[model samples]
Target: MAVTKAKKAPTEGAPVFFIMLRNMLIGLVSTVATTLMGAAAKGDWLIMLIYLRGKDGPDKALPSFLAPSTNGTAEHSVVDEFLEGYGMKHLHLFILMGVAGSFIIYYPVGGFWHWYYYVKRRDQAHEWKCQPNKFLTKENEAHAVMMGSFNMMLGGTLSGTIACYIVNGGYSRLYFSIWDYNIAYTVLSTMFVFMLNEFTVYWSHRIMHMPVLYKKIHKWHHRYIQPTAFTASAMHPFEFLLVQCLMAAPIFIFPLYAGSYVGVLLWTYYYGMKDHSGIIGESQWPWQQDVMFHDDHHLYFHVNFGMNTKFIDMMYGTVRKKDREYSEDIFYGFGREKTETKAQ
Candidate 1:
């Protein structure tokens, strides 16, 4: 026959590969749409409210060193030019991401817990409260929220500034592409960062409890002896800045995937509020300490300095011994003495 027979109509819908590809694309699009909607709902789109470019024109009054430049100048390197031209354009958004994004996360989370446990279910949660007899007064609660907000804003701005500086300066080993190394290495690096952070946090916190640092810097936070969720960030601005520095230090010290870095931050934020909430709860993992561990720190200062893990406290004997009174000298192996305060 001159012409080939017409191809038989396919009974099955499509090839399995094509079907799978279509499903994957649909899932991806749905995920993106969902994320965008969530961001919009959370007011992350506030990032779009400000820009370096003004309605009149680019702000030219800024000093040459500070101003964004598309062309390299004789005094500045190509790196500087690229940073100025590209990174500087997003400085406002970076700052907002730190300030607004932190508040967006912190307020909602802390507020919800505060409302549920402190206000709405006070009677129900009273038994589970680590300090059942103790609670921040309403005035004190307001003050705590105010101070926390102030410190968070200042700390967030400082964080944003440092982030802009380091990222634009190319000082950190933070990478976006997971394949730059491998998934295993990325995970290993994240674990390493968390462990290192725990070490630094435990040591720094213990140091802050030292006589001089405690009176001058750390006492501000301890004022909330029975801290609420809102009390999490209620610290001196200096202490807040120091924490930001600790947070930023790790990226410089290791090759951190951006996703891992963000995840660490989110966990830190949530746990910080949770632990300060005065709610008694079991540890999520065997390695992690319960919120009561920190509640005890606030209840009885100078012990339980470990943040996320009990390993350091166990090793250093900083763990609260119910049968003994902990003294500052415990750090030197000489302070704990027998006491009659029954374990809660």
Candidate 2:
């Protein structure tokens, strides 16, 4: 059901600080639960595959859970059994796991966010939607979901390949021990990558908005005028590749603790889903991001080009203007009015 509301000044009630904290906790809990579920499911799938493979063998002997080496004299753990059974190297297994885990984490978390904000609390959250009067048609939602799934699979594989290449070529400054430098340095490095991600997203996204590029590439994503969590990835393949590159770029550029590097990537992803989500409220905490910022970009087009942070847009004078009417020309850019009207 679509949550519709009349045009009026947004009534502020609950403190945005409390709201931000609550949303953060919900997102974190959802991610942890989904991650555990994905891990367990993956383990079971491996076990099943190993068992079935043994069943198809000449002797039909069940594979041992503890030691399932093909040679009778050799000893190996279940992990080794699966790796041996599939004839996969450790690096190959890592890439497969990375791709599968990305898909598992993305859809489930995005679905939960949609259900929570758009279904479970639609009326309660009506005032918070960036465009309360606007809604995506059922067909649009379905298209977004299908395209998002495809993009995730493609993007995940590309990211895994990039990660493997970086590791294999010894190009990345990734360190395993947190104390390789010091705890303070680890924290500082994470912050550095985090900001670098923001910078890259801002510039890359802004550049994509150029008339020629937007029409050819970025326009696929902007088709969803009223975006949901799923719409976060309903972008062109080239754009998806760019996103993968953006996530991997920081690792090659500077020193980063392994654990914190993963954390930074998660931070960027969590915020990406939230930003595209139509759920909207002004950010109260200095570090908290508001959905309205990016949602407005989809709605107003050619403005509010920054993600996760509004400071970049503010610095560059691209933020949507409050004094202007909501239209393509609300904030000026070359060929702003010439941009196609949003898809219905």
Candidate 3:
């Protein structure tokens, strides 16, 4: 009998087919969860209202708790108007469609970068494995599905509910529309949200790195050191809420002239997913410099802390200059020694 040596797994090339497949599955489950959650919540609310009405005659029931008043009459109570205007039939469908449309459009455009550019370029020298690796096992797939669904559902539900309250006050015009294409408005709003949310993410992310917090709130996300499409949303519920609130705060505070608000929100989601996509590729055009800054931070922590831009990092000398390369491994303390060794 002859003894044989074990062969090492291939480490190169884009997991194109599998990556896309995973993305599709994650997107599908996310869409379903979002739709079901919204519908169920609305249904439960309706049921509760009906029960209350039965217990206390319609006239005696609290008017504030009802839906939006359609009689061109302003109700004194907030609940009444909320109930009257809340048409579960169309609203639920609209929400489901909107969320589904968002993932469909966003993932293809922004999500494709990882497979097309980053993975293809980075893994050129490594061997290609046809089947899923240990990291991409069935368990990982399930985890990713749960993470994606929870992230989207939680973020969308919270933001949409808040928007419901604000929009009901005659601010429905803020929702994004096809006809409204104001470049200036879009740019300004995007920048504002990016700037504000960056702080929120940075602080929350930093906290997650802390020993105590990392053990609980943030550990699940970091479980995927080399993240895949599904790893994007694999975070704890508390982490999700904190980050989503930070992301949504600007939108709530700022009043928009047109429906560009929706565009801004969508843009945030698009970029947020891309940041976690584990891609590091250059954009096509000259002005669109290769800013894999955020994803790089996730891959090689402490280098790219800033979310959307490098301005603040650069200003504070925290920006990891490309010339000063860093390693994916090694927890060499912070500053010069860490940076220098990693760069080497």
lDDT of 2 by residue, 1-344 (tens): 99897665443466888878888997678656544333222121222222233223312222243223456433334544554454432334434645576566566666676787788777776567888777888899999988876776675456544443443333567666676798888888888888888888888998888778888898899889999877877888889877766777766777877677666655555566667778775675586558788887898788877777888777887777665445543334322322243432
RMSD of 3: 12.6
The most accurate candidate by lDDT is 1
For each candidate in the order shown, give its overall lDDT on alpha carbons.
Answer: 0.66, 0.64, 0.48
Clashes of each: 0, 0, 11
For candidate 2, which ten residues in a row score worst on lDDT?
Answer: 39-48
Which of 2 and 3 is the better model by lDDT?
2
- List all candidate RMSDs to the true structure: 13.6, 10.6, 12.6
The global Cα lDDT (0 to 1) of model 3 is 0.48
* Residue 262 in model 2: lDDT: 65
lDDT of 3 by residue, 162-244 (tens): 43334334233233443365667667766666556666665567656666676767667766655555566667888877765
lDDT of 1 at 212: 84
Candidate 1 local lDDT, 169-275, one digit each (tens): 44567676788899999999889888888899888898898878888898898888898767777888788777767877877777887678765654554456557
